[model samples]
Target: MTSAQVAKEHEGGEGNRPEEGYERGLGSRQVQMIAIGGAIGVGLFLGAGANIAKAGPSLILMYALAGVIIFFIMRALGELLLYRPVTGSFAEYSREFLGPFFGYFTGWTYWLMWVVTGMAELTAAAIYINYWFPGIPQWVTALVFLIVLFVANLISVKLFGEIEFWFSMVKVTAILGMIVIGLGVLTLGFSQAGDTAAVSNLWAFDGFFPKGVGSSLMTLQGVMFAYLAVELVGVTAGESDDPEKTLPKAINTLPWRIALFYVGALTVILCVVKWTEFADEGSPFVKAFEVIGIPAAAGIVNFVVLTAALSSCNSGMYSTGRMLRTLAENGEAPRVFRKLSSTKTPALGTGVSVIFMGIGVVLNYTVPEKAFGYVTSVATAAGIWTWLMILVSHVRYRRAVVAGRLPSSAFPAPGGAKLSWVAIVFLLFVTGLIAYDADARVCLYVMGGWYVALVIGWSVLKRRDPQVTARRREPEFEKL
Candidate 1:
């Protein structure tokens, strides 16, 4: 079938899924794993070390604080997902509630977020490999992994899900093992670190907020970035075999995921080793293992974190393709992105996104010292925008339901629209934090230029395709 035919078949055919053109290949197991994988990634594996150096043990509080807000955001999204689950959950909700312009901006910005995030991931993966192969160039390794993941994603969604399932499995297993080991050291007092390892470590070393509360709050940018892809489960709503059953279950587990993998893990790691000893450039997990004198600790944690980076980059590839197709179907992006290969992959979107991510290779080559910092700052800024859109969309969605313009969701949030507003304000605060940081402030400038480009592209699209400016139809209450 032609590309247009495929789009029509999926979106407009009677008695068909809204995500018809897409393959429903991601089963429950894969969705759960994807959720776990997204919850923990390079940000925690690597970024936390730097954040800890600055925030001290207070970094754990940063994560817990942010985790609560993240829970609110995901529950809001869960409500919307049940209302109308699609691959481009953020963009679609914005289109329906906010307007076409917000939708267009959200769609493209999310795509950009993941593309740069992919770059950051690729760079991080290379750094992880450097633990063993110090001689290889970072750019070379970044290029190799980028190409491998691109090819893997090109084959089929099932393959992507399968690969993600295993990648997430490694991350989950690694964190659990690390936590267990740390707890053992704390209770048994057998390992070398055990002599000094105590819960008192958290308050010792000049107090928990050693750097003061302001510095710890500043770490929220990186802390929130650590939780960035936790929402990828919403994006998978389209391909999930059972959206209602799987999406809620996946989102519900996010609290403990954040607790165990982020807050809980950090608490244990800090208790085992003083946060002061962590190097800004190294993985804390690796550092903890090495401090405990575990044999080959560096190599073992390196491999797990390598998978974490690759896993997030892999997700970037998947989400960008689906977002591109969403934009294309709505006449915002290039229609060629609407095409699915015989293998049911959005090859064009994935291909184009990977090419953009190749910019990371160049960044790694010329500015290896600063590539991860630069790309992550930008990705975090973009992620904040995408999240704001989601919260705002959820708030608007709740307003409509209350006004009787739409039906209430089956999985309504406990605090309703109030929590969404709280999440929005908190995200805006994080955005303010990003602006204040000199190193991260540049991302806001990048986003300023990006918004200008999006506005221009949107206007251009408006003239060429009337659908680009068309407002979405209002849905009646009760049933589809």
Candidate 2:
């Protein structure tokens, strides 16, 4: 049968798993790059300035500590993905291990998270474009980028993968080049900045915690936000060529990617120029490059950050569609969302998501400065919820396996439930920190509203289409 036909055949019943219908066009390299790209966003490029102004050199410790928690989260997710790799990701696991309500909430919450994130990325991309084309309106650039990525995602999964691969390559190359240059300044004294380039810069400025320990602690909100999309790899499992192998490999590399990109890069930048020299005005990378006397430093770094923005927007386009499809398959969303196009893509759902994402262009046109910031905290909270579900689901899945109620996974997480609990607690602590921040605390209230909305939505779904909200049949271990 044709793939779409097969996909249709398997639908209309809860017997099939959520990941079955899509094409596995993503290869190992694409999966790895997606993971890397997800980990590295414009947050590092631009947002770091404000964070540095808050935490000083101690920001490195926050990223490192959070990085460890993120690793545990991914390892837990990795175990579940190996057992039942699906595009539905944590949303699906939540359904199986938690219940239909949680699955429904996670699926829709993830969809909202990416849709808003797409808007933010588009806004960021448009602003970066303005640096080069001063007359082009932010809304115009945002619309153009949204259309390009939407079309790319619909054409085929492979095209989406290729677009992301190249986008991530630009980001990876820029960070690597900057690190190498920074090291040269420190060791071989390559640049004029080398005159003062000393690792001691990390300590010389206010002894690392210049703003006090509480100030450093407060940067956790931004640090965790920077780590938001690393879980994108889990969603790629359904479309990956060999998920069992690729997913684990993609997740395993997250620690080094976090280290090199966040911790290592920051260490070098802080070493090359003390944290005190950094400001919340623009990219520390751009400023450092200018200090190093690199030609067109602003322009080059702008291009890189622009790519960072577009890369993330592209990912949002790709993932939101899949999340919608997963929700549809579970009857939590409209039935039409489950349909696959000739290219084996969720065209309808993706198009709907893109339409909503267009609101970002409008926001950019109107609010320009606050458009991205307004939605970022909500997105971070949504991400934290997604991670919480993954850890909880993994813990539950492990317990079932140990009880022999379900077979063990091919890839088991080390330290099992204990590690998952640690990650969960750390995430909760971050959530508490978010609640503590006056400006950020509003997200908690927003999320409170979101939860009530979900509760209402769930009640409506269960009443209107009992089948849509039907509990999934108990999971069956795959036959060897």
Assess candidate 1 and give its lDDT: 0.86
Candidate 1, residues 1-480, lDDT tens digits: the string is 322233334454421223558888899999999998898888898889999999999999999999999999999999988777778888888887888899889999999999988877788788778878999987888889999999999998989999999999998899999999999999999788989999999998999999899999999999988888988998898888888889999999989888999988999999999988987778899889988999998788889988988998999999999899988877888878889999988899999999988986686667757756878888888888888998999998888889877777778988999998988989989889888888889999999999899988978887887765875634423233
Per-residue CA lDDT of model 2 for 1-480, tens digit only, reads: 322233345443343557767889999999999999999998899888889989999999998999999999999999888776778788889998998889999998999899888888888888789898989877878888888899999999999999999999999999999999999899998777979989999998779899899999999988888888999999898888888789889988988999999999999999998888888778889978998989999999999999998998899989899999998887888889989999999999999999998976686567756546768888999999999999999999989888877776777888989999999999999899998998888878888999999999989987998876777646645221
Quantify all predictions' global Cα lDDT against the true fold: 0.86, 0.87
| Residue 332 in model 1: lDDT | 84
Highest lDDT: give the candidate number: 2
Least well predicted 10-residue stretch by lDDT in candidate 1:
1-10
Question: In model 1, which regions exceed 4 Å deviation?
Answer: 1-18, 134-137, 476-480
The worst-scoring run of ten residues by lDDT in candidate 2 lies at 1-10
Alpha-carbon deviation at 195 in model 1, angstroms: 1.4
Q: Tell me model 2's lDDT, rounded to 2 decimals.
A: 0.87
Best by TM-score: 2
